[model samples]
Target: MKESILLVEDDSSIAIVITAALEAEGLHVDRCDSIAGRDCLLASKPYGLMLTDVMLTDGDGIETLPPVRAAFPRMQVIILSAQNTLDTAVRASDTGAFEYFPKPFDLEELVRTVRQALGALDGSDLPDAAEDLGQGLPLVGRSAAMQAVYRMITRVLRNDLTVLILGESGTGKELVAEAIHQLGNRRDGPFVAVNTAAIPHELIESELFGHEKGAFTGAVARQIGKFEQAARGTLFLDEIGDMPLEAQTRLLRALQSGRIRRVGGTEEIALNCRIIAATNRDLVPMIAAGTFREDLYYRLAVVPIELPPLRERADDVEALSRHFLARAAAEGLPRRQLSAAGAALLARQPWRGNVRELRNFIFRLALLARDDVVDDATIEPLLASDNAAQRAGEPEAGIGNAAPADFATALDAFLIQARPEPGTLYDSALAAFERPLFLHALAQTGGNQLRAAQLLGINRNTLRKRLVDLGIAPEDALGGR
Candidate 1:
């Protein structure tokens, strides 16, 4: 297995040089230009070593060092900075930095330091081996929708075919990618991922295929690309829809011929990597509109998998809520549980942002809730107020100057006239308002209909009647939404 290294430097030139040197030495490198990019990388896989600069556009690289070290205690880190000073070096060391190099240091020395760091560390030092990769850390709920995703992942892992995962943002697309990588035969190999939308358009071609010295204006040295680094492993391309037409042609060629040629280089390099591409956008539409290549679409869709949004899996809300709460507790936050009402509210809410959004909200609640138990009262306002604002002018469930008789009547009216072709509007609206309001209210009332009604300024009997009228069963309501 190739040792994996995360190169977190903002300078494109330096990143290219370091990546090439490391690859030349047979080490796998994942490059990140900012802290946010680093965070996204860390979420999907573990790295053997981390090389970070002191200053980054998004935040200080030092701030990233401590958490990374804590999470992967055995993983070594080296600080490379143009702003290197005694105080900076001391701070980096204090955060368990393996070594410090001043800016403009020798690439050979950097490579040697990396080798020593890797030799000094053991595999057991990485994060818990990413237990059950595709399934991810226990994310609750046995809803058929979630179960289907689990089953699909299981099937995908049994083969090496390309996969295209379709889902909205925050729907755990990368998690699905990770699961595929960890469960497959190449689990031991490095999993290198690239976000097509994140890199600048002009530089993206070189970023993926690499560039020889003088390939472009600032291409001062030879650079190895992601495809070569991910050899014998998985290469996850997130937001594949954002790849440019020119790059797409090259990528398709690589997929078809199993070879890649670096920019400004004459030699063609053979590729031995698996491809897993993901996108929230509809590729078929893009292809129809002449934005995405139809041939590439067919190639990526060999084993396509679509993820159901959270609102569609309302049955899993309670389970997911508890799972996130436990995760928070494990992270040393105040321990908290979802009250019956809170859980019900969670279940009913339209989670437009999906599971990831739910997790963030739970973390926030865990921090703010006064007691160990989070009730409907506490969760309701947060979901309803913010989500209600989002729903105000939307076609479904909007409260315009013309108010309907009651909440249900208004919903029915909105559902009737504003309904688009059956599935689209219902799915979109369910994701938009009704669900969020229900979840928010249930959370506020601690899962008690009477309390939730009182909180909503309605009679308890009315609340009960409305809950039934909305086809919300007691079990489903009490579960999380």
Candidate 2:
């Protein structure tokens, strides 16, 4: 005799597909379209496992699970739903569902999950109901790409595992952190967020660890650091990849010991909060460059949640546009509705800056749209003009049409990522500026050191030494290394 499973889904088409998939896997299946019907089927015979949807014709699938749990404590349950919201995911987790699959889930994956649930009921670890907290985070998306992120958020809600959110700039990494903090066990505690990049390198330690009065030239009074302020709460570290190496050492020590001491204080304080870190930069290259600490990366990545960039999840663009439109109207901006054409147009954009850029554009459109509706025709001109204005605001590349280098832009970028000891800023900035200039001269001279030297208006020996100092290969040629 084959093992039997119960599937409770309202849609006949979905029920048929699921039943067929399971039956193809060599399982006997009983299906129902209502909660009452599900109960009727369950009472008729013991099921090897149950697959349920949150909504049913007769009653709520998840709400009615308590009775099922009481009647069949050992049977595992998997939730499938079309609601496709974070709230649904959490609710399913609260019922200790083996897994939550939002609609349009991969059938093969679902079949695999069913096999696993039936095969290891006792050994499997379910997300405990102890983490039933947090109003569903205000993340708006039904994209399949976002389902993984939603699942990750629900898992960490039951524990204090440190989370690291990674994504491109404006991809809502901070929002993911907020969701974990807001939905996790420590929801009631304060959620203190600090951008590690915004603080000066000299004062970053003092900001995070707090400093004693008279501890340094500017220390006049003792103050509480973010860690102490966020006790019994969550301390979010944004732009964590940019933290100074020295500060990373201190932070690692604090995380390891679960305690901290003020810069000059004698008393050590115990940590009572959770840690969540996020960064947009790719830490792998930084690790290779010796700019980021490998040990610290491992510590912060206990529950890493990588958010998909807006471009990767373009299917959500329409929903996100409307979501932002609703907010803009609620904030007193003119109300506007998105048309299918407008949404299609928006989705076609590269969205290079990710969600943040899209959100900004939507707000501007809501305020500027002459019609209550936005379509390709209406948004197209605005886009061109908006892009034009942005270009106008940008610093010119050079005076020539031959495309000379943009040193001003380059310098600004360098300063942003510049890490240099005081009084050495000149040397640091100089080297960065000279390397490209030297490389260009070398390329211009066709591998001849003397000619390259003359082209650079410097002595041959001096140019040779500078090339070695800057580590520029003398063999470099155009269009090749």
Which candidate leads the pack in lDDT?
Answer: 2
Lowest lDDT 10-mer window, candidate 2?
Answer: 396-405
Candidates' RMSD to native: 21.7, 6.2
**What lDDT does candidate 2 reach at residue 442?**
65
lDDT of 2 by residue, 170-261 (tens): 88988888887777778899999999999999999889989999989879999899999999999999999889999999999999999999
Best by TM-score: 2
Please report, as a residue range, the 10-residue window in candidate 1 with the lowest summed lDDT. Answer: 123-132
Give each model a TM-score. Answer: 0.54, 0.83
CA lDDT scores, all candidates in order? 0.77, 0.84
The CA-based lDDT of model 2 is what?
A: 0.84
Cα deviation of 103, candidate 1, in Å: 59
